[model samples]
Target chain A: MTMFTVLEGVAAPLLRENVDTDTVIRIERLVSLEKVDLGHWAFETLRYRKDGSDNPDFVLNQPRYRGARILLAGRNFGCGSSREGAVHAILGMGIRCVIAPSFGDIFFSNCFQNGVLPIVLPQAEIDKLAEEARESAAGGAFAVDLEAQEIRTPGQRTVSFATDPNRRRALLQGLDPIATTLQRDGDIESFQQRDRQARPWIYG
Target chain B: MPGQSLFDKIWDAHVIADLGSGTSLLHIDRHIMHDLGGGRGLRRLSELGHKLRNPELIFATPDHAISTEPGRTSETTPLSSGYMKVLREETKKHGVRLFELGEDGQGIVHVVGPEMGISLPGVTLVCGDSHTCTHGAVGAMAWGIGSSELVHVLATQTMVQAKPKRMRVSFSGRMHDWVRSKDLILYLIGRLGAAAGSGSAVEYAGPAIRALSMEARLSLCNLSIEMGARFGMIAPDDTTFEYLAGRPFAPEGRMWDRAVSHWRTLPSDPDAVFDREESIEVDAIAPQITWGTSPQDVIAVDGIIPDPASAANPSRRHEMELAQRYMGIEPGRPIAGTPVDRVFIGSCTNSRIEDLRDAAAVARGRQVAKNVTAWVVPGSYIVKCQGEAEGLDAVFRAAGFEWREPGCSQCVAANGDVVPPGQRCVSTSNRNFAGRQGPGSRTHLASPAMAAAAAVAGAITDIRQLA
Candidate 1:
C-alpha cells in the first residue's frame, strides 16, 4: 500500500446515493482484468457507452475532472457488495480520497487496506465541497491532508475530519496491518487454548 | 453488569484481544470463501510468505464464477475457468476443504455454510461475499470481509474489527396470505431507507420472525446487507436446531446435546438493552418488488411507481429520476402489469428447497408466457436432488421454465447465464442494482412465487391475484 498523506488534485462530483460496488467495477471486469488495470473499467457501465466509447455525460470522463484524485459522493456511497475490487478500481482511477455523508461498513474498511481515504462528512459539508468542485471545474483542486486531518477546497475553506487513530497511523506509514496483528500471536494462542478446552466441537 | 444482547454475547466470546478504540482482534470460528476472492487471496498470502494458520477453520468453494449449465465442468465458463482451477489448487495446497462443483455439498458459499452446519449459533463466521450475513439466520455472528481481510483471516485465523452497535428489529403481527419472508425484508428496506441499518448489528425478533421456517429466516437475513447492516441474526430456537440436526458437519450424540445447550443460551437476555429498537407490523405487507436500481427503491407489487417530484430531497429526487429512466419506468404508473422478459428463480437469498417448492407451486399446471424465459437454478446440488425427488423439476419443466444446475447463476451475471441487455427480469435475487443481471438489464427483486407469477403472466403481477 502507498502512504497517504497530503493529496491535492481535482475532485469529481459523483453525488448519487448508493453508488454500490457493482457500479464501481462490475463483477465481469473484476474476473477478467488485473487489479492494476481495473482503472480502465472502473464505472464501466456509467463511464462508457455500449459501443465502448466514453460516455461524455459522465463526470469522470469530462476533461476538467480527468485525473481527479478526490471523489465527492452522496450518502451511503459504496453501499453494496464486499468486493475489495471496488477500492482497487477507485485507486486505479487515481482517486486517493472519497468524501461522503456515510459509507458501507465493509467498503469503508476496504478503503483503508488500499490506502484510499474514505472521509465521512456531513451532507451539508459534502454539498458545499461538491459545489466548489463544480464551480471551479477548470482548476478546483481539493487538498486532503491526512496528517492534518482536514480538507482544503479551492475556495480556501478547510473542513476537519476524524478517522480511527490506528487506521490513520497505518495509512500514514504504509504498514501492513497483518504484520502488526501477528506480533500479538501470544495473546491469540492463549485465547485459542482456553476456547478449545471450553468448546472442543467448535475447533474441528 | 446489566444484560447482554445476542450480538454482545457472541462478540465477547470471539474477542482474542481488544486493540483499543472499540476494535478487537476476533478469532474467526468459521471462514468461508468463494472462487472469486479465495484463489486471489491465497495466492497473495503465498506471495507474502505466509502459511495458513488454521486450515481446518477455512472452507472454500467455486460458486461465484462457475458455470451453472447442465453437466458443466470447470471450463464451462472459459473466463472463470482459471479462477475455479486456482481455487481448487490453492485449497488443496493449503489443506483447506474445497466443496467441488456437482458434489453433494457444493453450492453458493452462504447456502453451503449453513446447510453443512459449519455456521452455528454463537459462532463468528466471515466470508469474502457480502451475503455472508445469510448465515446469521442460524444465530451466528456473521459478516462479509474484503480481499485483504481474507488474507489476514487466512494467515491468523482472526480479524480486526470495530464493534457495531446493537439494533433489534422486531416484526409483529402475522403476514398476509401471499406474503413471504422475502416480502417482509423488502418491505423493511423500503420503509427504512437503504442506509438505516448502517454501523449496527441487527437482531430480528418477535412473533412473526419466530413463526418463520428456518429457510424463510435465511431468506430474510440474507438481505441484511442490502439494508446496510453487515450482521443480522435471529435467536437459535427449535426451528434452527431442527434445521441443523443430522446435517453433515453438525456435532453428534453428546456433542449435539452440549451444542444445543450452548445455543439455547445465545439469545439476547430478557432485560438486554439495544442501542436502537424498531418494530414493524407485517400483516399488511404485500409481495414487495423493486421498480428501480437500488433494493430500497421498492414498492408493493400492486403499488405505483414513485414520482421523483415527491422525493424527500433534491438529491433523492435526482436519484429517483435517474433510476426511473434507467429502469424505463414512468412515475406514478402502477408497477403491476409491467411486462417482463425473463424470470430468475435462484440466488443465495431464495434458492433453498422451500423456495423451489414455492415457485413450483405457482408454476404447476401453468405455462410460462410465450415471450418470457424463466430458469430455476437450485441453491445446491443436494437441493437440486431434493427438488427432483419431490417432482418440482417436472412442474417447472412442464411450465416451460428451465430447470438448471446449482450455482450463483444469473444472480451476479459472471457465470454466463444473464438476462440480456435492456430486458426486464422478475428475479428472486437479493440485489436489483443497475447492470446486476447484465448490462442494461432491469431487475425487479421479488419472492419466488411472485417471480413464477411473472413468468406465467409475462409481467409483474400481484401474487395474491394469482392465488
Candidate 2:
C-alpha cells in the first residue's frame, strides 16, 4: 500500500451528484481488465466516443485537466456497488485524492485501503474549489496535506477537513490493515473461543 | 444504559475489541463471496502470504459471471469461464466450500445465504457484493465489502468497522393490494432520496414490515445499499424462524430450539431509542418504478415523468435533464404506456420463489406483448426447481416469457445477458443507473408483478390496473 501523506497536482472537476462506482468503472471493464490497467477505461462511457475516439468535452480529456491527480466531485460520489475497481481505476488514473460533499459508504472505505484519500467537505466548499479549478490558468493545482488535514486551493485559500484519526494514522504510514489487525490476533481468537461456546449454531 | 436496538445488540455481540476513534474489531460470523471477487480475493490473500484464518466460515458461489442460459456450464459465458474456473480452483485449494453451477445451493450470494440458513439472526455477515445487505433480513448485521476488505476477511474472519448510528424506518399501516415489499422499499428510497440512510444501520419495523414474508423482507433489505445504507435489518420473528426452520444449513433438533429462543431475544426492546426515527404509511404506496437513472428518480407507476424545471436547485435540474435525455423520457408525459424492449424478472432483490410466483400469477393465461422479450431468471437453482415444481415456469413459458436458469442474469450484465444499447427494460433488479443493464440501456426499476405487467402490455403499465 502506498502511503498518502501529501498530494499536490491538477484537480479535475466532475461535479455530478451520485456519481456511482458503476460510472467510475463499468462492470465490463472490471471483469475484463486488471486493476493496474483500469486507468484508460475509467469513465469509459463518458471518456470515449462510439468510434473509440476521446470525448474532448470530458473534463479529464481537456488539456488542462490531463493527468489530474485530484478529483472535485459532488455529493454521494461512488454511490453504487462495492466494486473496488472504482478506486483502482481512479488510482490508475493518478487520482490520489477525491473531494466530495458525501460518499457511498463502501466506496469511501475502499478508498482508504488503496491509498486514495476521500475527503468529505460541505457542498458549498466543494463548489468553491471546483470553481477555482475550472477557472485557474495553472490547471487546478491543489495541495492536500493529510498530516495537516487541510486542502490548499489555487486561490490561496486553505480549507480544513476531518477524517477518522485511526484511518488517518494508517494512511500516513501506508500500513496494511490486515497486518495491523493481525497484530491483535490474540483478541480475535479469545473472542471466538468464548463466542463459540455461547453461539454454537453460528459456528456450524 | 439505554435500551439497545437490534443492530446494536448484534453488533455488540460480534465486537472482539474496540479500536479507538469509534471503530471496533468485530468478528464476522459469515463471509460470503461470489465468482467476481471470490477467486481474486483468495488469490490476493495468498499473494500477501496470509492463510485463510477461518475457511469454514467462508462460502463461495459463482453468480455474477456465470450465464443463466439453460444447460449452462461453467464455460457457457466465455467471458465468465476464467473467473468461474479460478473460483472453483481457489475455493478447492483454500478448503472453502464452493456451490458450483447446477448445485442446489447455487444462487445469488444474498439469496443463497438466507435460504441455506448461513445468514441467521444476531450474526454479522459480510460479502463482496453490495446487495449482501439482503441477508440482514434474517436479523443479521450484514453489509458489503470491497475487494481489499474481502481479502482482509479472507485472511481474518473479522473487520474493523466504524460504529454506525442506528436508524429505524417503521412502515406503518397495512399494505394495499398489489403493493409488494419491493414497492415499499422503492417508495422509501424515492421519498427519502438515495442518501437518506447514509452512515446509519437501518432497521425496518412496524406491523406492515412484520407482516411481510421472509422472502419479501429479503427483497426489501436487498435495496438498502441503493438507499446508501450498507446494512438494513428486520428483527427476527416467527416469519424469520419459519423461513429458516428446515433449510440445509440451519440448526437442527435441540439446536434449532435454542437458536429460536436466542433469536427471539434479538429484537429491539420496547424502550429502545434510535438515533433517527422515520415512518411511512404503506396503505397508499402504489407499485413504484424508476423513470430515471438513480433509484431516487422514481415515482408511482401511474405518475407522470417529472419535469426538470420542478427540481429544487440548478444542479438537480441539470441532473434530471441529463437523466431524461439519456433515458429518452419526455418530461410532463405519463410514464405509463412507455414501451419497453425487455422485461427482466430476476436479481437478488426480487428473484425469490415468492417474486416468481407473483410474476407468474400476472403472466397466467396472458401472452407477452409482441416485440418485447421477457426473461424469468430465478435467484438460485433451488428457486428455479421450486418455481418449476409449482408450475410457475410453465405459466411464464406459456406467456412467452423465457424461463432461464439461475444466477444474476441481466442484473449487473456481467453474465452476457444484457439489454441492448438504446433499449428500455422494465427490470425487477434494484439499480436503474445508466448502463447498469448495459451500455445506453435504459432501466425502469419495478416489482416483479409490475415488470410482468409491463412485459404483457409491452409498456410500463400499472400492475393494479391489470388486476
Candidate 3:
C-alpha cells in the first residue's frame, strides 16, 4: 500500500466504454494465475493472438502507451463482475489510476480498496483529457494529484475532479477496506451478540 | 421519520456500525463460496493468523471450475480437480460446510443457497461470485464481493459497504407463453443499457414479478449483475416463505413462526418512496436474445441485428460497432435463423428445474440438428435428481441433447467446457462477452426453450415457432 499523492505518467487511452471485468482480465487468467502478473493479460484476447504475439493494434499494445501508469477511458468502465482482478491487472501493469466519465460501482470501490485511484469526471472533461493524453504520448505525461483533486494535462491545463473525502484519505494513507473494517471489531461483536438473541436460526 | 423502501429496511437492519459517509459495517448472514476464488481467501486468512470467526455462517462449493461432463469426478481435468482439492482441504480444515462435487448437495453456489434455504428472507448474503444476487430472489439483500472483501467477511462475518440508493423497477405485464422471465430482464437491459443499474439496489416489484415462480424470480435477479448492479431483490412474501418452508437450512417449529412474522414486515411500507423509480408496462414481450457481445445488445426474436450507424448516441454507436465486429455479425441482418454450432441450456441464470422443464418441453420428440452439439447441464444434484424423477432427462436425451451433471459447464469456460474458436452458440448463460465462452466463440444469450429450439434448428429460432 504505497501512498498515492501525485502520479505522473503516460495515460493509455482505452477509449471504449463499458470495459467489463471480463475484458479487463479474463477469468482464465485469474484461475491459473500465481503471483498475480495478470496485468500482462489485460484485454488478452484483444491484446494478443493465438501465437502469443502482441496484437499491435490495441492501444495498450502500441509502444507509445505500453507502460502507461494512468488510463483515459470511456464511460461505465469496469461494468460487469465484481472481480478485483480487473483493478489488480490495471495496477499490476503500473497504471496507478484511471480517469473515466463513470465506473462500475464495485470496480470503483475495488480500485480505492487497492489504492488505485478511480476518478469520475464529466464526459466533456474526459474527452479533452483523452485527446491530450494521445497528443502527449511521445514525451510528456498526464499528471493526477489526489490531494489537489485535479488532473494536470501535458498542456498544463488543470482539470478539477471530486472524490469522497474518506476515500481520498484512504488512498493517501494506503489503507485497505479490510483494515478499515477491523477498526470496528467491538461494534461488530456487539451487533453479533444482539443478533444472536434476536434471531438464533440465522446462525449455524 | 421517512418511510423506508423494502431495500432500505433490509439494509438498515444489517448495519453494525455506521461508518459515516454512507459506509457501514454490515453483518453478513451468509457467505457462499464457489471454486473460482473460494479457498484463496481462507488461505490468506490463515496466513495472517486469523481463523474464520464463524465457519457455520459460511458455505463452500466447487462449481466454477468443476466439470459437468457425465461420469465426471474431480479428475475430469487438471484444472477442475485442482480447484476441487483446494476447497475440499480448506473447508475441511476450517470446518466450513462444503458441497463438494459428486456429493448430494453439490451444485452452483447460487442454486444450492436457495434450494437448501441457506439464503432466506431478511438476510444479508455475500459470495465471491458476481451472480450471488441470484439469492436475492428470496428477499435477501445479496451481492458479490471480491477476494479481499471475502477475507474480511471470513474474519468478521461482516463487510464494510456503502449504502446504495434504492430503486424500484415495477414490471406489470401480460406475458405471452413464449415470453419468459429471461426475456423481461434482457428487454430491460436492452432499453436501459448495461450501465443503467450500475450503483442502485434494484427492487423488482408489481404484477409481473409477483406472478413469477420462485425459480423465475431467481432467474430475474440472477442477471442483475449483467446490467451493472451488484444488488437486486424481491420483497419476501407468501411466495418466499412457502418456497423456504421445511427446506434444510430454514427455520423450524416456533422459530419458523417468529421468522415468518419478521419477514412479513420486510415489504416496503405503504407510504415508502424510493430514491428513484422505473416502470415497464408490458402488454406482451416476445422472446428476446442478444445479437452482440454485450448483454444489452438484445433484440426480440423476430428482430434484426442492430446497425451501429443508426445509433443516436456516439458512445452507444461506438459500442455497437465494437460489439458487431467482435460478435462477427453484420448490421441489419435478421437475428432469427442466424446459424449456431452449439446450444447450452444451463447456467445459474436458467438451470433450475423450472427452467429445465421448459427446455425439455421444447426438446420433446425433436432431434437435435445434425450439425449441432447441445447440452443440458442441471443447476445442482438436487435439481438433477428432481428432473430425473420427473423423467425430464429422458426428454432431453431422446431429443439428442447430452444430459450432464450439474456445474457451470459452458456458462463459464473455466474448466474447459468451451465452444471452440469461431463457433457460434445459443446459451442460457448471463453474459455474451467476447471470448466469454472461449476465444473467438460467439454466444447469443437466450432462454432455455430458445436454446432448445436453436439446438433442433441448428440456428437461432423462436420457441414459439417450435411444435
Q: Which residue pairs in candidate 2 collide?
A: none
lDDT of 1 by residue, B1-467 (tens): 77999999999998998888999999999999898899889999999999889998888888888888888888886766888878888888989899887787798888889889899888999999999899999999999999999999989989999999899999999888879999999999998989988898999999999999999999999999999999999999999999999888888899999989989999999999999999999987989999999999989998999999998888889999999999999988899999999999999999999999999999999999999999999999889999999999999999999998888999999889888999999999999999999888999999999999999999999988998
Error of 2 at B217 (Å): 0.5
- The window of 10 residues in a row where model 2 chain A has the poorest summed lDDT is A28-37
Which sections of candidate 3 miss by over 4 Å? Answer: A33-36, A137-139
Fnat per candidate, as a fraction, reads: 0.67, 0.72, 0.54
Error of 3 at B394 (Å): 1.0
Residue B83 accuracy (lDDT) in model 2: 94
Q: Candidate 1 at residue A183, lDDT?
A: 97
Off by over 4 Å in 2: A33-36
Instruction: State the lDDT of candidate 2 residue by residue for B1-467, as single tens digits.
Output: 77888998998898888888899999999998999899989998999999999999989898998899888898886777889878988999999999977888899998899999999898899999889889999999999999999999988899999999889999989888899999999999999999888888999999999999999999999999999999999999999999899998899999999999999999999989999899999987998989899999999988999999999999999999999999999999999999999999999999999999999999999999999999999999899999989999999999999999889989999889999999999999999998999999999999999999999999999898998
Q: Score the docking of each candidate (DockQ).
A: 0.76, 0.80, 0.65
Off by over 4 Å in 1: A33-36
In angstroms, how far off is A188's CA in candidate 2?
A: 1.1
Model 1 lDDT, full chain set: 0.92
Using DockQ as the measure, which candidate wins? 2
Candidate 3 lDDT over residue span A17-85, tens digit each: 788888889888888835558878887877887799998888888888888898888878988777899
The superposed Cα distance between candidate 1 and the true structure at residue A66, in angstroms, equals 1.4
Fnat of candidate 1 is 0.67
